[model samples]
Structures are given as structure tokens and as C-alpha cells.
Target: MIVLASQSASRKAMLDAAGIAYEAQSSDVDEGAIKRELIGVPGGDVATILAEAKALPVSVGVPGKLVLGGDSLVEVGGRQFDKPVSREQAAEHLRFFSGQRMNLHSAAVLVRDGITVWRHCETARLDVRQLSDSFIDSYLNREWPAVSGCVGVFRIEALGVQLFERIEGSHFTVLGMPLLAVLAALRAQGELEA
Candidate 1:
């Protein structure tokens, strides 16, 4: 069995949908501190770094088990955006994203006995349509609860899909878990059936 080190519902849904069996456990890592430390790194590398950080500690605690950790971030106009803390910030992010292309980078790592066995990071670009302030207000009112948990202030699985005019890359990448690659890695490691 694999151990999932994350509290994200989207990630759980991804694994469940893929038929990968995993025990969910929240990995306590100081993400804010890590983000601060890697302020100048590329978005995808930062995501990979955070994912490894989450996996290592949890893998150490559950020695010999397959522990998977994942992280995602939005890079727009050369700036990286994490999850929004408030509706206002989400609204602001959407406004800035209006009619622009933004990259969603997701990274995943597999660790066993505190050793990283596999790692992958993938990037997807979303082209958001121009949105009006009124639309933003209504969208926020409807999705803020679910939206705040995701980077880029959009779910892409729910009404958030409507926010994009076009998307380039894997759907799973935008969901904050590069799941297909992870699945392949699991099979290679003999944790999942080939």
C-alpha cells in the first residue's frame, strides 16, 4: 500500500479515480518557510522541492512504506503564486490572470525509508479569458470555498473550468498532482500492478 502525504482533496480524488490505493495522512511541513527560502527558484523546481520536503519526513516516520508527496504552484508573468488566503486575493489573482497565459507546475515525489525513489514535475499553461469585475464577484461567491485551496485561484474541475479560454497540458497537472507519471513510477517500483 502507498501512503499519501497530503491533505488535499483534489489529490485524493486523483488517486481514487486512478484506482491507486493509498492511506491519506497530512504531512506537516512548513511550506511558507520553504517558499521563502526558495524565493528565486523556478516554479517547477520549487514545487519539486516542496514535494520532496513533504515526502522525506513522512517516509522516515513510516519506514519501508511507499510515501508519495505532491505540490503545485502557478507561475504567471514570471511570478509564482501560492494558495490564496482570502477571497479578495483570489479575486485579485483572477483579475491579473484575465486574458493571460499562466503556467501551473505540479511536482510529485515517492520516498521509501526516507530515501527519494522517484520524482517528477510537469507544467501546464492556462489561457484565461478576460473576466469582468462583476463576473469575478459572482465566481468568487460561488467557488471561493473550494477555490482558496488551489493555486491560481481556480479549480479547473468545477466552474473554474469556465475561467480558461484554453489549456495546454495534462488535466491532472492542473489538478495539482502529475498523477499519470506517478502511477507509472509506482508500477515501475512494483507498488502497483503492471
Candidate 2:
């Protein structure tokens, strides 16, 4: 089994649905501080960097065992959104994204014995349909608690699916893991069945 260096429910669901064996644990790093220090870095690169930060820590604990870390971020008009800070912010994200296209960047890193081994990043484009103020309000009321933990304030597999009109990318990438690539990497490393 691999060590999943994140406690995100979405990531856990993705792995569980894939029948992948893993242990979930938090890296406990301050992601906000990393973002602040990397000011002006592109969203995709930031995601890749953060993935390594999480994976490296857990790899240290398990010695030679594989440790996986992943992160997802949303980019709208060059601005990146992390999980919402409040219900108001979540609503604001929806308002700005209404009738616009946003790119969701998901990245994963694998490490062994505290050394980086492999990494992958994938991007998915989502077109959010025009949304009315009432819809935004009701959406936050029903979904904020659940979605607030997700970047873009969405969990595309849930009510969040209603917010999008079109999506272009791998389904798993949008769900926040480059899962197929990750599986391929694991198999390549002799950690999973070939």
C-alpha cells in the first residue's frame, strides 16, 4: 500500500473508488505560507510544488515505501482560487465564474525514501454556465460546507456538476488526481500489478 500524504476527503474518495490501497495522513504543511512565498508563480507550477512538499514528508516516514501527494487549484482569468475562506467568498467565486471558463489544475507527486521519483500534472477546462444570484445563494446554502474544502468551490461529482455547462479533460483530473498516470507510475515502479 502507498502512503497518501493528504487527508483530503476528495482524494481519499478517488483512491478508494479506484480500488487503490493506501493510508491517508496529513502532511501538516502550511500551504498558505507556501503560496505567499511563491507569489506570482503560475497556478499549475504552484500545485506541482506543493505536491512534492507533501509527498517528501511522508516518504521520509515510510523509508522505501511509495508516498503520494496531490493538490488541485482553479484558475479564472489568471487568478487562482484555493478553498474558500468563507461562505461569502465561495459565493463570490461562483459569481465571477458564472458564464466563464476556468481551468482546474491537478498535480501529483510520488516519493520514495524521501527522494522525488515521479510527478504529473493535468489540467481540465470547465465552462460555468450563466448563474443567477438566487442560484448562487441556494448553491452556497446547500453546498458550501461540502465544497468549501475544494478549490473552485466545487466537487464535480456532486451538486457541483450542476454549475458547469461543459468540461474538457480527464474525469479523474477534474476530480483532483491524475489517477491513471499515478497508477501507471506505480506499476512502473513495481508497486502495483503490471
Candidate 3:
């Protein structure tokens, strides 16, 4: 059976929509500490490390199971924006992204028997619409709780899409998994039924 080593609803939905059977289990890793520890690493490398870190523990515990872990971050002008920790931070993230194009880096790792079997990183560019103060305020009020950890301060599946002027990337990457790549890896590994 496939085990998703993440608590993300979007990732679960993606698998479900594709008819992939999997169970969601939080890896319970200290993500913030992991990011801090890998601060010196390149952003893409850091994302991959974190993804593997999240999957390794789960893979070790469940022998013979394929465990998938994924991570995403928003980068603007060489700066990484982590999930907003407060309402004010969310508003600020929106403001910083306003009228600017930012890159979203998403990395995924698939582990089996405590070893990484597949890994991939994908990036997407999103041009955020110029946000007015009022709009930012309203958006924060409505989405602060749900969109906190997401890189772009918006959930494309919800009202967050309205904040983007344009997007250049696969839908799955934007949602944080890069579904096609993951599926290809799974198929190649013969983990998913053909």
C-alpha cells in the first residue's frame, strides 16, 4: 500500500482524484528546525532534504510500503517566504508578492524500506496581481487560517487564485506535489498497479 507521509489535504486530494490508493500520515518532523539546519544549502536542495527527512521515518516504520513526502517554498528575489506565522505576516507576504512574479519550488521524495526510491523538484512562476490594502485585508481575514503554511499566501483551489495575474507551471506543482512526476516514478518502480 502507498503511504503519504504528509498531512496536506491537497496532496491527498490529488492522489484520490487520480484513483491512487494511499493513507495520509503526518511524518511529525520538526520542519522549521529542518529548514533552519539546512539554511546554508541551496533552496532546491533544502526542499529535497526536507522531503526526504519527512519520508524517511515513516518508510522505516512501515517496511514494504511506499512513503511519499513533499515540500514547497516561495522565493522572491532570492528570499524564501515560509508559511505566515501570524495574520500580519500573511498580509505582509501578500503585500510583498503584490504585482511581482515569484517562483514556487516544490520537491518530493518517495521512500521504500528506509531508502529514497525517487525524488523530484519542480518550480512554478506566479505573477501576483497588484493587491490593494483593502483587498489584502479582506483576503487575510478570510484565508489567514487556511493559507498560513502555503508559500504564496493563497490557495489556488480557493479564493487565492484571484490574487494571481498569471501562472506558469503545472497545476500539481502549484498545489505542491508534481503529480505527473510522482506517478511516473511510482509506475517505474512498479509500486502502483499498471
Candidate 4:
């Protein structure tokens, strides 16, 4: 079984649905500090760094077991967006994202004994449909607190799908992790059947 270093529902659901055994553990990493430190870095690389940060700390405690960490970020119009802090903020973000191309960067890392053994980052491009104020209000009314945890202010597997007009990338990537690459890495590590 792998040790998961996040409480994110999407990542946990992905592993659970894929039949990957894992135990959820919070990494306790300070994400805001890391993002400040990584100013100007590419979104994909930032995701990888955050993933590694989460994994390395957790791996130190569980010496032999593989610890999996994952992170996702959203970049639209050269601006990086964090998870919205409020319903109003989410609405503002939705307005900014309207009719814009959003780049979603999802990354994952495998660490054991404080050493990273594998890392992967994938990017998904989503063309957000033009959003009207009424549409944004209605969308957030139903999706707010739930999507508040999402970097893109949306979740692809749920009502969030309505926000996109076109998407060009792996479905798993848009869900917040590069799950295929992660499964492949697990197979390579002998954690999963080859």
C-alpha cells in the first residue's frame, strides 16, 4: 500500500477508483510560502515542487513505504490562480477565466525514506466558455464551498465540466493529478503488478 500525502478528495478518489491501495496522511506543508518562493517559475514546475515538498516530509516518517504526493495549479492569461477564498472571489476568478484558455498543471511524486524516486507533471489546456454574470452566480451557488478547494475553481468530474468549451489533455490531468504516469511509476517501483 502507498502512503498518500494529501487529504484531497479528487486524488484519493482517483487512487481508490483505480484499485490502488493507500492511506491518507496530511503533509502539513505550507503551500503559500512555497508559492511565494517560486515566483515566476512555470506552473508545471511549481506543481512538481509542491508535490515533492509534500512527499519528502511524509516519506521521512514512513521509511520503507512509498509516499505519494500530488498538486495542481491553474494558470490563465499569465496569472496563476490559487483556490478561491470566498464565493465572491470564486465569481471574480470565473469572470477572469471566461472565454480564456486555462492551463492546468498537475504533478505527482513518489518518495521513500525522504528520497524522491519518481516525479511527473502534466498540463491540460481548457478553453473556458464565455460566462455571464447570472451563469457565474448560478454555477457558484451550487459549487462554491465544494469547489473552494479546487485550484481552477472547478472540478472536471462534476458540475465544473460545464465551464469548459474544449479541453486538450488527459482527463486525469484535468482532475488534478497525472494519474496514468503515477500508475506507471508505481508499476516500475513494484508497488503494482507489471
lDDT scores in order:
0.92, 0.90, 0.88, 0.95
lDDT per residue for candidate 3 within 133-182, as digits (tens), equals: 99999888888799986877889999999898899999999998889999
User: What's every prediction's RMSD, in angstroms?
Assistant: 0.8, 0.9, 1.2, 0.6
Better of 3 and 4 by TM-score: 4
Instruction: Show the colliding residue pairs in model 1.
Output: none
The global Cα lDDT (0 to 1) of model 4 is 0.95
| TM-score of every prediction relative to native | 0.98, 0.97, 0.95, 0.99
What lDDT tens digits, residue by residue, belong to model 2 across residues 57-125? 778889878999999989998788888989998988899999999999999999999889898999999
Error of 4 at 120 (Å): 0.4
Which structure among the candidates has the greatest lDDT?
Answer: 4
* Each candidate's clash count: 0, 0, 0, 0
Question: What lDDT tens digits, residue by residue, belong to model 4 across residues 97-126?
Answer: 999999999999999999899999999999
**Top candidate, metric TM-score:** 4
> What value does the lDDT take at residue 47 in candidate 4?
96
Q: Rank the candidates by lDDT, best first.
A: 4, 1, 2, 3
Clashes of 3: 0
